[model samples]
Target: MMQRRTLAAGVAAFSALWLAAPLATAAVETPDALVKRLSADILETIKADPELRNGNIARISQVVDNTVMPHVNFRRMTSAAVGPQWRQATPAQRERLQQEFKLMLIRTYAGALKQVSDQRVVVKPLRAAPEDKDVLVRTEVHGKGEPVQLDFRLENTDGKGWKIYNLNVLGVWMVETYRTQFAQELNKGGIDGLINALASRTIAADAKTAKSAQP
Candidate 1:
């Protein structure tokens, strides 16, 4: 369970690096090229920024909100994580789920990305065809340890270009992992119960992150 949580944290952090791209280059760049460009760009920016490196949770959340949230199809991610219960969730419940999930990811991102050191992300050659709507972009984080495999599952929309909806971090699919957990919550407590549970976790996580970020 601890190991699973660790891998999920990797998903959260790398999801930020890959999704928090430099605005919308979606129209001009192909998905692989987009990943390549954004991965290097975000990492370099983090390496250069002192506050980001030091895990200022507020600053990290702000950066992620400004750069990461816009690019990701997080509504779809939340839907998938919620499984079939998503369709049954009322508008308010869905909205709450989205907000809590995003907050949890931002807090998770603070801890995960802070582990970045002298690492550089190298995107492997992409194999998908030009017109492919759904594709995977594979990459490896090369640094002190062995190269960690991180793959992105993305969808290309008409005007939205490419949006990441799922992440494969070290062989674990983030959405599926969360789906299993969320299903447990839904079974035990239903929609409101799930939302409340997510809210509680995110609040606790944020408080812990905030306490650790102190001087």
Candidate 2:
């Protein structure tokens, strides 16, 4: 369990790097190119900004908002994570879950980003066809010993460009992992119960943050 959590944390940390790459010159592209562009951009920003190297929460939040969220399809991710429950959810419940799930990820990822230090990413080229709308960009994150494989799955949008819908770390899909946990919670507590649980967790995290800020 600890190993799984660590892998997930690593994925969250790499997510910011996964979004900063430049797309291919071809009119049609693959996931590998997108991941490369996103990761490069993220590294560039951190390299240029010495303060962000410290992993301050505020700075991490800024990077997430500016460089991460814009390219992530949270709604789609949420739906996929929820699995079958997603189809059963009413529109309102779906919306609430989507919002809560996005917040949960942002908060979770923000916390993980604070743990990122001087880590270098090694991009491994993968074969992707032009017609492949959904592709996973595979890379190994090196530093602090034992490189871990990170994969970002992206889908091309009609006009908004490429957006990330899933991430795989060490052969585990982050959203899917959470979905299983969430589904168990829902089964036991129902949709409202799940929402309340997520809210409580967020509130608790916030309180912990506030307490840590004290002198």
The candidate maximizing lDDT is 1
Error of 1 at 79 (Å): 0.2
Residue 84, model 2: lDDT of: 78
Candidate 1 local lDDT, 1-215, one digit each (tens): 65544454454348447435475442557778777777777777777777876767678777777777655789999999999989999999999999888877766666566565566678888898877888999988666545677888988777457778998888889899999989889999999999998889988986786777579
Instruction: Give the Å error, residue 93, model 1.
Output: 1.0
After superposition, the stretches of candidate 2 with alpha carbons farther than 4 Å from their true spots are: 1-9, 18-29, 47-66, 157-160
* Candidate 2 residue lDDT tens string, 1-215: 65755574466456456335343455544556666666656766666765565445566566566656666887898888877777878899988887677556656655455445565667787767766666677787765656777878888867446788887788888887988888888898877777777887778877877787789
Write down the TM-score for model 1.
0.88
Whole-model alpha-carbon lDDT for candidate 2: 0.68
